[model samples]
Target chain A: MCQLLGMNCATPTDITFSFRGFSQRAGITSDHSDGFGIAFFEDKACRLFVDNQSAVESPIAELVRNYPIKSRNVIAHIRKATQGKITLENSHPFVRELWGRQWIFAHNGDLHDFHPRLSGRFTPVGNTDSELSFCYLLDKLVEKFGYHEPALNDIFTALKEISPQIAEHGTFNFCLSNGQALFSYATTKLHWIVREYPFQHASLIDLDVEVDFSEVTTPEDRVAVITTEPLTHNEVWQAYQAGEMILFQHGRPIKQAMTVVERLQREAKDPSLKRVTKADQY
Target chain B: MCQLLGMNCATPTDITFSFRGFSQRAGITSDHSDGFGIAFFEDKACRLFVDNQSAVESPIAELVRNYPIKSRNVIAHIRKATQGKITLENSHPFVRELWGRQWIFAHNGDLHDFHPRLSGRFTPVGNTDSELSFCYLLDKLVEKFGYHEPALNDIFTALKEISPQIAEHGTFNFCLSNGQALFSYATTKLHWIVREYPFQHASLIDLDVEVDFSEVTTPEDRVAVITTEPLTHNEVWQAYQAGEMILFQHGRPIKQAMTVVERLQREAKDPSLKRVTKADQY
Candidate 1:
């Protein structure tokens, strides 16, 4: 299993604070420490930093923690090397350009035997199942709508329709963004929180660090943070129900859809595969 | 025009020393200032950093100058934006994955009225002639050799043949690499230097910096540095010919080819465009 962190905000917000806590999972707090990667979007352009080294000690990860590269949409991952070798190419938070917009993606859970036929349009450079899924999704998007890019809602609709097929293979929790909006899907574990006006102090669960958000943010600023687990202990983080997909924009969850996890549970080819339960609900 | 810099070496080497001097051209030493970018390859994986801000003042550039990220091949660019807006998407040192390998490219010259028919296998993320050229080259390479990546010599042959077709539009000096070999094509300006066992002292032309290579390198270390102009004033740099393509491997020029600049000169479709000359040789 890997860990994912995503942020979408109304204004450009520095993720250094959240990243510092989330990155601790790479080695210090927990052990998902095969590799780490992060993508910061400035408008349609993205500055992606990926290293095969552990995030706790990687110089690039240190740079990311210290430098405040503000972005409306950001995705990060700390890998545990479930499916690929620990190489720079295998690190998560993969990037590709579609519709003249750079799309970034990061995955958190493993997809067992999930190999979809790629259209050779958006091929994976690395041999990771995560990257393969991303490529397959992109190819499907391109296939559904030719040359020109469709609306975001249409894309979400297409993604909603196709995500279950991949999810059926195994746990498929992922965060994807095109800088305009962030789309997150979960068949297993995922949590989210929105920090807006009247933001309060929060303490990191992994580190003995606390931050008073009021001191650093304007009243108009709003931030949506999604992660495998809640980074802060005090904040009321909302856990995604199994087989739920949510679209986050302007620091809030605006839309959601349900998958066929229940239907698949009723008609299970493998009884042990459907691991959803009441605990998965928010 | 933009300024291009590339490094290919026998061993992994940090480029902070060269980058410090080269980045100075973004604002302080010379003005190619619109944006800047650099791409470093670690095996088949790449770490690409681009900024719309001038390298002299960009914090990311400062980080690059301070951090010792080592690589065997690197491509850097400082833009004097002639074709596109000064945006991150339009920054040079564009990257794309081809044949499971990340291909990096940076250009120093322009291509006028040059829009080739894209096969949709590869597309430009940004609106730059440099990026278009990179895409067209990749698409053509894929078309010529489907699925499998070809040999370095075959790639050089294909590049040697395809380069002139793009160059016919305008000046098209560029550097491209796939972590295996560095391929450089020159129509107007490009210079290269190789530092080996018997290294000597060299001083940057743009900065008051000097380094004795013998103290920092081993007998086995070999490095080939290519730029739009010689980065160091004291080193004997070899300039690329008017229409020449060189494939550099293991820090040395291993193969070379000549383009039809002379033929274009003989049959000038536009009298104003034929700028090929004996002065181009060094």
Candidate 2:
């Protein structure tokens, strides 16, 4: 399993504050310190950094804590080795090119004998199930939509249909981005929140620090954050229902759907192994 | 640094499939495998699993891949050893008790020289900065709201104000939940999306698997996922702006705000250390 952190906003901003608290978990306050990586979205491009060292000890992590790189969206991760070796290539918040844009991904769970067939549309740079899953998703997308990018709504609908089939094999909870909008889904646990006007003071749960958002942000600016757990003790965090999938644009959720848990459970009891696969039309 | 995976939906769903693909990156695919942990929200309470072994090799992870534990929300993490020693106490998706409810958290990034005075109202169970940050946050919430939980909106407002203060110390991105809604913030990188009707096939970038979501969900179901990267290769993921904060309810963004990066950058240029701390206050 792994930890996830994400940010989405209406305007460009820096994630130094949140990253400060989040990085601590990698080595200091909590033990996620396997490897760490982060991606910052700036318009159509993104700035990405990843290290195979524990975030607490990584020089890059230190730089991130001290430096304030601004962007409209950001994603960060601390690895807890599940399948792959602890190396730079294995570090997450994995990035790829899709539809002429950068697509980033990070995963937090495991799969069982999940080998699937693929075309040349998308390929995994790393050997992780996460990367493989990412490639498979892209391959399916291209196969269905071809070269032209589809409307976000259509994409979201397609994801809703596809996610469960993947989940059927194992725990599949993840966060994804393409410099435009964010997509997240879960089979076990995921949480998120949006922050806007009338901001007040917030304090970190790992460090004895605080901030007043009202002093820095405009009323018009909005931000959305998603993570495996709440970073602050004072904020309101929302939990995703089982079998749920969501799409976010401009720091807000625009679409959503549920996975097929009940059906899977029933099948699990039958012992027939008659499972839902990609062969079944969605 | 660590990786995080999350899911939120209108109905219960199992994360096995996505976790199977994502976990491959832990040790077999990417190498985050210092440790792994996952939490599943079953109604109000959550079922959590943490392993000091690589998720790819852990029997628990294997069970996760084979068994579909249905839940509305899920959070998972893979460690790479940054802060605390590689032990269970250091694993992420950290949980705490607040307002008579369980609060869970996981982070990605690092903090610098971020020791703060605590009031003992919220004490750290671990030495990681992430957990300390969680305790500190709870302490502040207790200071401001006393015993009774405030409205989610009010809490969001308070968090917005305080997050920047904490960010001043270093990066402070995280996700928080209390069995109700999810709250997330980023000072660096984070992304999210929602999935709903009109499902289609999607592929994974890390593996060779694909799924068709349309086969599993209904028109009424909605889901939101937040992560450090996009899990699928083909889908368009939304990115979070720097210094942004967000509140999510029912898988939708209800409040958002962007942090001021320009000011922070200017302050970063200050030569004196004392001035640097003061600049963080601004």
Candidate 3:
């Protein structure tokens, strides 16, 4: 398992507050101390910083915590290394160019025995099931839209249709961004919160740090933060359903979808496990 | 014109000392300061930091100067923005994925009216003639070697054949790396030096900084540095000819190639202007 943090804001903003809390899980508060990486998107261009060192110890991660890099979209990951070895080549989030736009992605859960065919154009530089799935999704999107970049809604619909096939393999919680918007999907655990005009003071759950957002934000500012778990204890975090997908833009979710239980029931390889899931949901 | 700095070393090494003087040229000593970027390679993985702000003022650049990030291959660029606007997208060096490896490049010269036809696989996100030439070169390499990666010597030979075609447009001095070896091509100005055992004192040309290298390095340590201009005045720096290409690996030049002067002489559109170059030699 891994810890993921993402932000999609209406205006350019820094993630020092949230990232500081989230990175504590890398070594201090939690034990996901394999490696970590983050990506910040400024319009269509992006800057990515990755290291095989733990986020708590990496000097580059220290720069991220102290420097106020303004961006509307950002994604960060702290790894526990379930599928890949602890190496720089295996660190997330991964990036590739498609339709003349850079796409970034990070995964939290593990997949068992999942491999998809890839088009020669987009190949994974590192060996990870997450990277393999990312390349597969890009190849499928290119096949769907050809050389032209389609509308955001069209992409959302296509992702909803294609996500279940990958999710059936195992836990498939992930976050993806295309600079314009962020797309998040969850099968096991994920939570999100939106902060707007009437901001209030919040305290970190892992560390003794507090901040009054009202003093730092203007009336026009809005932001959405998503993560593997609630980062702040006071804020109301919304958990996604077992199989749900959401596209976030301008600090809010613009579209949402879910796989119906009947469909999952029909697609499951073991019918007996579906009955167990129904009992557990109660 | 921009300034480029590159390092290919036999072992993992830090460039904090060299970069301190090199970054001083952004605004303090010289005025090539449109923006700046640097990339460090750790095996097949990389860390790229680019800022559209001048290195003298960028806090990220400040962090770079202070942090000792070690790598075997490093490339840095300070831009003057000849063909592209001053923005994050237009900052060099540009990156692309080819044959399942990350390729990084940076340019130091201007190209006028040079746009080569691109095959759809590799596209330039930024509007720079430097990026255009990089994509053109990668496309030609892929066409020449299909899916399999060729031997390094064979690739060097192909670059020797293809570089003159791009250089005819104008100055095409650039450095490229694939995490394995560094390939440098120059048409106007570029210099390189190899530092090994029995090192001596060196003084920076642009800044009042001097360091005795003998105290810092071991007998097994070796490093090759390539730059647009010589950084240290006291060291031996060899300049590349009008059209020379060198491939550096294990901290030394393993192969070299030069384009014939007769070819460049024949390709020049203005025949009567050759006398100006004759005076430069004197």
**Model 2 over residues A45-68: C-alpha lDDT tens digits?**
455667678988876677678767
The CA lDDT of each predicted structure is 0.88, 0.74, 0.86
Best by TM-score: 3
lDDT of 1 by residue, B143-257 (tens): 9999777899999989987888788788889999999989999988999999998989889888999999999999989999999988998989998988888888899899977
Cα deviation in Å at residue A118, candidate 1? 2.1
Better of 1 and 2 by TM-score: 1
lDDT of 2 by residue, B123-241 (tens): 45446787778767766787788766798888877777667667776767778776677778887777887777776667876788988888877776667777776778877777777
Model 2, C-alpha of B38: deviation from truth (Å): 36
Who is ahead in DockQ, 1 or 2? Answer: 1
Compose the digit string of candidate 1's lDDT tens values, residues A1-282: 999999999999999889999999999989988999999988887889898899998888998899888899999999999888998899989988787788999987777767788767777878888999999999899999987879989999999878887876778899999989999999889999999999899999989999999999999999999999999989999999888899999999998887665446554777766554332321
For candidate 3, the lDDT comes to: 0.86
Interface RMSD of 1: 1.8
True contacts kept of 2: 0.00
Superposed model 3: Cα runs more than 4 Å off: A260-282, B260-282
Q: What share of the true interface contacts does candidate 3 keep?
A: 0.41
Whose lDDT is greatest here? 1
